[model samples]
Target: MNVTDPKANLAALIKCPSVTPAEGGALGALTEMLSPLGFKVERSTETDENTPDIENLYARLGGEGPHLMFAGHTDVVPVGDEAAWTHPPFAAEIADGQMYGRGAVDMKGGIACFVAAAARYIEKHGKLPGSLSFLITGDEEADAVNGTIKLLERMAKAGETWDACLVGEPTNPDKLGEMIKIGRRGSISGWITVFGTQGHAAYPHLADNPLRGAVQLANALMEVPFDQGTDEFPPTNLEVTSIDTGNAATNVIPAAAKVVFNIRFNDLWTADSVKQEIITRLDKAARTGNLRGERPPVRYEIAWSIRPSHVFLTRDDKLISSLAGAVESVVGERPKLSTTGGTSDARFIKDYCPVVEFGLVGQTMHMVDERVALADLETLTQIYETFIERWFADART
Candidate 1:
């Protein structure tokens, strides 16, 4: 069978419509593409109570020492208004020099480039000296309930392991060789509801306004600095995403106010420590009563999101240096080592092996008509191919 072109592979994937939680034929397409490259592919459908069933792919071309795994997601977020796109979101149309689609860069493009590079390597040099595999998931853009985490757990149960991992997340900010993510900050979300009493605006003595307590609590949460900038990461930051009283009438004082906030914290604090700090802030804020200081003590309930993303850093010389060298050789620029992005599946893969992220420029990811330059696909593939050679060579040493 003729090897599929990387751009073609990406176009095929884009056509799958595998919008998060929807299989959209992305994995099936990948299995078909990898099978021709001598990969032994196995598809697993993972499930949880609330989220939809997700199909994940794990393919290996060889079973040997010092494996290199490429991880990425196939699921793409919904294209807000398809009609608004210059080209059809999933049409995979190539115009001028770019491929236009939803997951083109955020990262079906990454998966395609790596697969193409692996194909070229096998064609030119035969099977890898070690093992070459892919850990592709379909639940990344969603709640992540049945994606990499479950896939990793299942693999561990089945005695699967690897030496290093490179997550194909779009890490570059402005240009293709601008950044490589060496680590990521931890993330946690908190939801709080302050309880008060409902009454007419005229009866200030009878109704305790929850917004008054909420203001104090929010201020306390934002007033204190979580930490200064770490060596690899920036200072911890929090943002209030929402504040809702749900009150419709001008005269009505809602009995409750809900506030939601998320924190992206660095290694200086653990999730437990961060939670404690937040609780402490909330406690102090709760003691602060209404502006008039006449209402009873304010009451509120706090709940943290179930899943907490832990901060991680990778310092593996072989893994980091090889990828950096590859980027420098291909793009003619040394990539900056960074840990400044939001988060990726690398957070989970970090627990298993030393993992870092490098992919195409991410400026257009997740935006309308998300896209990648046609030349970028070829360049990224070359980078991956070079990285593969450097990785296996260094692995032997």
Candidate 2:
């Protein structure tokens, strides 16, 4: 099948219900597309103790220097209330110029467009001037344990290296070329548990409520700003996702309370420094808080979530300018270079090489009817094709 048509490629991928860990034939479909284009495609299934084994693909064309990698995921979040969708989430149905599917915009659409772009480039030039590879994974929407991180490690260990990478995450908020992600904020999550005495509600004087200390600590984390906004990034922000007590009866004060929070920090701090800052705030709140009524530092403990994502920025001029120029040439406007979104697989890729992200509009991602416009898909294909030509040209010079 001719893979130059992005609409056709996206529809084939969308028809596979490749929800995390489920292969769902999405990788197989992708293989079919890349193989015919003369890509030496290799698929690996990575496994960890508890995470479901992941299916990842690395396909390379040409055996030369200045390798460029297009990174993205095939798996999608579960379709919530399948009945709520206008069309079946895996049907790849089209309605009024939009193609609706689970990964339509966040981001099977991106992968489809890139594949089509590569195919078109091959069709036009016969072969690329430099190496081009697709680093596709099936674990982005879940635990993420057995996906890109592992695939990258395996590839690097085998001596595979890339000069730069482009992540096909849904980056635009409203339009196709509105934004391009040059960096991402770091993320860390922790659970705080405070211990107290259980007692009757009427015995307030005798009972120590853990909820009081938990709220105090939670407030401290949010009340103070992490930092003023930076030039390349927004100010760090922390949110209390949940505060819970297992107590069933309102009259009985719970013996313990837990506060769950996640912080998105900027370049102003590293993961360790941000963690230290959090500890300082918690300690200060515990010592000075009146909620415990002089109860010896409001005993508490913290358990950090595993594998915090680190913050990073890409300063590769040629890579950024090539993509930016491509978008401007195709869309008639230079895209804004930004670092405003939550963390992504780009965070992992950044450690290996300079990385940036660009893709379809993200308004409907993870929504009831996630989708992409056909016109936007075509435009994105053009942008990717132009980027391919420009990146290789710039690398040669």
Best candidate, TM-score: 2
Write the residue-wise lDDT of candidate 2 on 1-397 in tens digits. 7699999999999999998889999999999999989999999999999778898999999898789999999999999899999899999999999999999998899999999999999999996888999999988888788999999999999889999999999999989999999999999999999998899999977778999999999999999898997999999999999999988897998899999999999999999999999999999999996665667777899999799999999999999999999999999999999999887899899999999999999999999999999999999999999999999999899
The residue-level lDDT of candidate 1 at 383 comes to 93
Local error of candidate 1 at residue 58 (angstroms): 0.7
Badly placed stretches (over 4 Å) of model 2 are none
For every model shown, what is its TM-score relative to the native structure?
0.98, 0.98
lDDT of each: 0.91, 0.94
Model 2 C-alpha lDDT versus the unseen true structure: 0.94
Clashes of each: 0, 0
Worst 10 residues of 2 by lDDT: 289-298
Give the Cα error of residue 329 in candidate 2, in Å.
Answer: 0.3
Q: How big is the RMSD of model 2?
A: 0.9
TM-score of predicted structure 1: 0.98
